[model samples]
Target: MNKSELISVCISDNRVCPMPPQWVKFEELLSEMGNGKPPQSLILGYWFDTSDEEKRKCVQQQIDWAYERGLLDFAIEYLTQLKPNQWHTGYRK
Candidate 1:
């Protein structure tokens, strides 16, 4: 899917968050994230389905960094392997 589609999926997946995260072109949005700023989890969360190609690519590059730091990337990578409907019904063939 394209960047916008990807972003939509990611946000929909994380609908539980009260302030569903969004990508920013401004420093102010980064500030709201926190002092250390845009923590890896938040950054990765904004990565998957962002509408901006540059931002998505940048975030993709940091997936390993986020994973190494024990943030959101770890779980997302694990769950990503479980493709849609592959787990359900037990066997496809």
Candidate 2:
């Protein structure tokens, strides 16, 4: 899909935060990187869908840091989901 369509899907599905103007720019940037195909899961939940362990760790550390600084209202649900490896998949079949 095009960038606008992708943004509409993301917003409709609650993938990315919809209220912030920066999110539109972020989607634009991601679409550019993806050659117009936005990474759905990453845009949905960066901490949830990333496959790189280092990136996940970095994001978690940042969340922790933000919480410590009172910059975030961190939630346990963020850590409750199974690892990406455990997610069920049959879409490719």
On lDDT, the leading prediction is 1
Q: State in Å the error of residue 42, model 1.
A: 13
TM-score of each: 0.26, 0.27
What digit string (tens of lDDT, one per residue) describes model 1 on residues 1-93? Answer: 333443343334322111223223212333343233443332445644544444434444333334444444433533244344421111122
Q: Please list the residue runs of candidate 2 whose C-alpha ends up more than 4 Å from where it truly belongs after superposition.
A: 1-51, 74-93
The local distance difference test score of each candidate is 0.35, 0.34
Clashing residue pairs, backbone N/CA/C < 3 A, model 2: none
Kindly list the per-residue Cα lDDT of model 2 for residues 1-93, writing each as its tens digit.
333333233323223232223333433544453344332323345534544443423334433443444433222222222244332222221
Report the alpha-carbon TM-score of model 1 versus the true structure. 0.26
Candidate 2 at residue 32, lDDT?
50
RMSD of each: 12.2, 14.8
